[model samples]
Target: MKKILIFSASIGNGHNQTAKAMQESLGEQGYSSMIIDTLEYVSPTFHKILLESYMNLLRLSPKMWGKIYHNSERSRLIEINVLMLLANKLKKLINSVKPDAFIATHPFASCMLSVLKGRNNWSIPIYTIITDFTIHPSWINHHIDYYFIAHEQLKYLIDIYREDPEKFKAMGIPIMKKFREPLDKEKLRETFGLKNNQKCILLSGGGLGLGSMEKVLDGLNNIDLPLKTFVLTGKNQKLFRKVSKHTYRHEVVPLPFIDNVHEYLHVADLIVTKSGGLTTAEVLSKQVPMIVHNPLPGQEERNSHFLLNNGCAVHATVSEQLIYFIRELLYNPIKVDHMKQMAKRIAKPNAAEDIARFIMEDMASKAVSKVPLGGE
Candidate 1:
């Protein structure tokens, strides 16, 4: 079996989640894959607090978060130090696993691979999968063999930076296998103790629950719609408890880091979420229309653009607008149908399988090229 090493960081949950999905896909395709958190390999304590603080800042002060994100994108000087550390570690990792190829789902890993390619040559292939629709300069490097971008727009964006148009492939975004599977809407709704006719709006603030979850709930509670709301307060116990206390006539279900997002998506009429690439892709796979609420700046702003352009989702920057949009969407079934159809059209259900097939084919070609002419 071919061996693949998937690298991801815990800065955001999406990167690690994508790595897990890809690992599972490769396993089902008869490939041995290992998923490793790059930050844990470096400094667990620093990464933990840094990741937590990043999420908290995004929730409390998105403008500050945006500024920091933008600054990080431009700081090549600081990146050189990061690149050196990553290069040394990667040299050790590759020497140990001897993977046939390396797949990176995080920007830091991509940058490190670029730096390593210049310093030391690895005969094995290196692939970078952009989890977001937007492209950052850090995600580009001349040494990458293949790039799996979330959209065609990202391909163009990266080509502008890397100056190689042929290296990138717009494979759509990758999502968990469950999102690609079919779920019975009525059955799922009944299982969740929700009425068959009542529209369920699923609200998510990402894995760390970084958005204004309580404020959004309050706004939705004041709305004059007969809709049930499901809030996923991932890793945010305070927000979950506070939202659950609101005794609204319509049922409000508050959860903490649920494993069955596909089930919720199956029964949800609309999804109100921060426009993280992975969540957007999952929602697309489920054929659920979206209302992006308070997207973190930089890549998320670009992610919002992709959904808006595709007619798969709408944007609401404030709580009041979010509630109004929800009310309108729940009332106007035709518009909601249109959005859902657009989302379905864009969903690449076989993305993970497609990527695995490509990698395996490349591996086969390489192995065949190395055969001796007179070998038995």
Candidate 2:
């Protein structure tokens, strides 16, 4: 079996989840793949400092983070510095792993590997997945062999940069294999102990402490509809405890980090979530309409914009808007059905399988033809 090395970052679970999805798909295609958290592996201290600083900034002062995010279009100081720090460690890892190709779910991984491959004359491929609705400049570079984007509309990013358009595969973002399969909603509801008579509203903060779920839950208490709500306070014990202890008008169930996210999604009539790329993709794949809460500046805002423009989600700027959207969507089945249709129309449910097949076929053909590997 051909060996594949995938590099991911821990900025959020999205990056690692993206990498794992690809790994699982590739494994089904008879490939040996492994995922590495490059950020933590390269330097644990730097990883902690970076993640903490980023989380704090987004929580405490999001405008400052937004300014830095936008200014990065004209400058790659952070990416460059990360690339520099990752170069030596990544080189050692690659030499040790000796894989046939490299895959990156994070920009830092791709940028560093692209440069290192050219400089060291490594005969391996480097593929990247841009896991967002919008393509940031940091993810754009000349040396990557191929890019898998979330949508065809984002092809303009490649076209405007004078890169070969064929280098991009707009195959949608790869999601878990389980998400692509058909699920029984009734069974899912039974598994999760959901009430059949009440409306099901699933609220998630996108696996990170990114949104105001407590405030949203408090507002939800005022909704007069009969409801069963599942609050996914993922990996946040404090938040989970608080939400679990809090009283509400309806049955509010709190869940910690769960392995069966797809199941909860399948049983939800409506979803209120922060607009992270992975969660959005998962929600869309399940054909559930969304109410996205106060998105953080930068990519989250961009993701929310894409969802709003696509007609599958409501962008709520504050608690009131979020509550209003929830009430409206809950009572209006016609609008909810329309949004679900739109989501189904745009959802790439076969993204993981298609991407796996494409990579496998491309690699086999390249090997048969003996073409030089690892270049743009």
Candidate closest to the true structure, highest TM-score: 2
Local lDDT at 160 for model 1? 62
Clashing pairs in 2: none
Q: So what's the TM-score on candidate 2?
A: 0.93
Tens digits of per-residue lDDT, candidate 1, 1-376, equal 6888898998778898889889888998899999878767766775687688877887688898778778866765245776667456656666677677888998777777666655665566778888887877677776888888876656567556755777787787667788887778778778888875677888885433434565666667666667788888888788777777767667788888989998998888888888888888888888898998877887798899999999989999777788888888988989999998998887776778778888888778777222111111
* Residue ranges of candidate 1 with Cα displaced over 4 Å: 71-77, 205-215, 221-225, 368-376
lDDT for each candidate structure: 0.78, 0.83
Highest lDDT: give the candidate number.
2
Window of ten residues with lowest summed lDDT in model 2: 367-376
